[model samples]
Target: MRSQLRPETRIDRCFEALKREGRPAFVTFVTAGDPDYETSKAILLGLPEAGADVIEIGMPFSDPMADGPAVQASSLRALKAGQTMKRTLQLVREFRAKDNLTPIVLMGYYNPIYVYPSEAFLDEARDAGIDGMIIVDVPPEADEELCLPAIQRGLSFIRLATPTTDDKRLPAVLANTSGFVYYVSITGITGAAAPVVSDVRAQVARIKRSTPLPVVVGFGVRTPEQARVIADCADGVVVGSALVETIRTTLGTDGRAGPDTVSAVHRIVHNLAAGLRGAAARV
Candidate 1:
């Protein structure tokens, strides 16, 4: 019998498509209105054209504890600029208008989603063409009531598995996780510190044995070498804090990443993408 596709099938398809083309998918993240709406929009639009396989649009929230200081600061800037969940969805709608193929995953803490009825949030997400969601704070036990509806509505619930996730609990996490599994490479929050553990590859291998899902490693992955190292064992690499830091440095007090921002972003993403592509090229 043919197996049913995951709820967020587009994301799975994108991963497979990139693999077929001999490239480890590059998933880039940016806050929805980081510096301002227009620059955020430009980066989102430019990503796929510039070689990004998937885009994670961060929905800024008041308390982003899971994120490091840089992402928290970015979200604060977006909030101060009057960015709301409504505006973030509008960004997704605007993106869908031009590019419908590249999967877009909305990543953020759970408070904003909790503010809205789950059904309303899922419906709006579907209308805006969001392919998946990564609610950093929601564990699988709580997701049935809080997130399953989105799965029922054709959106992937991407779960985050930490180094602390053991064999007994890992299956439960993967059982509910759809699209692709997000394997946290470190023990704590997102940033450029060296990983807390030395056996991430072993952790990834253990997770892969439990399910047939594509595993994407994230957190503490800042440079091309780090990306290449993770890409060697995982399906993709997620880079957020590092890129956000670059944008933060580029932006002056005026809430803009300055004139040279595009060049800087392109340079960083290009290097990350190249590293991801290296392993695929050899395949």
Candidate 2:
């Protein structure tokens, strides 16, 4: 008998499509409304064309403690430019108006969503075409707070598994994780250090044995070469801080986005996508 068909989401189809192409996905992260709205909109619209398979839009927050310096600065810039949780959803709505295929995942802490009152935000998110979530603060123990509710609403609640996620804890992390598992290559804050390939590979392998979800490694992945190395082992690779830093450095003297800001981020995504492609060709 044929196996039962599983539900397919934009994120699910994205990984499946990349699997057929024999390549790891290149995921891009951008803080919505960083510096300003129009500039951030340009970056979001250009990402897919620039070779991003999936996009993670960060909800600008004040105390982004888990984020490293680069990402924290991005949040501040967005907040300074008047980016609100409501505006963040509008960014996704605007993005959905152009591209219907590339999956968009909202990555952020839980406070903003809690303030939005879980149900209302989830309904708005679904309407805005968000495919998944990467809430760093919500653990399996507290899945009822967000994860379970998100899943019930047909949204993939992607979970993060770190090198410190031992075997005993792996099951809890994977218990309700959907879309794909974001394997943080480092234990500390995001982008603090580079990830060793061997260590990442071993951890990815261990996580896979616990769940069938595609493991995508992130954190400390900055350059295209580093992306290629991580892509060689995992199902996908994520680059955030480096891309955020590009926006941070490219801002004008007055602290607004520069003329080349959008193009600069597109270039970063393009090169990383190329790296993943090159790695896939090798495989």
TM values, all candidates: 0.95, 0.97
* Candidate no. 2 TM-score: 0.97
The candidate that wins on TM-score is 2
Off by over 4 Å in 1: 1-8, 196-198
Candidate 1: tens digits of C-alpha lDDT, residues 55-111: 999999999988889899989988988899999999999999999899999999887
Cα lDDT computed for each candidate against the true fold: 0.84, 0.91
- Looking at model 2, report the run of 10 residues with the lowest lDDT sum: 1-10
Clashing pairs in 2: none
- Give the local distance difference test score of model 1: 0.84
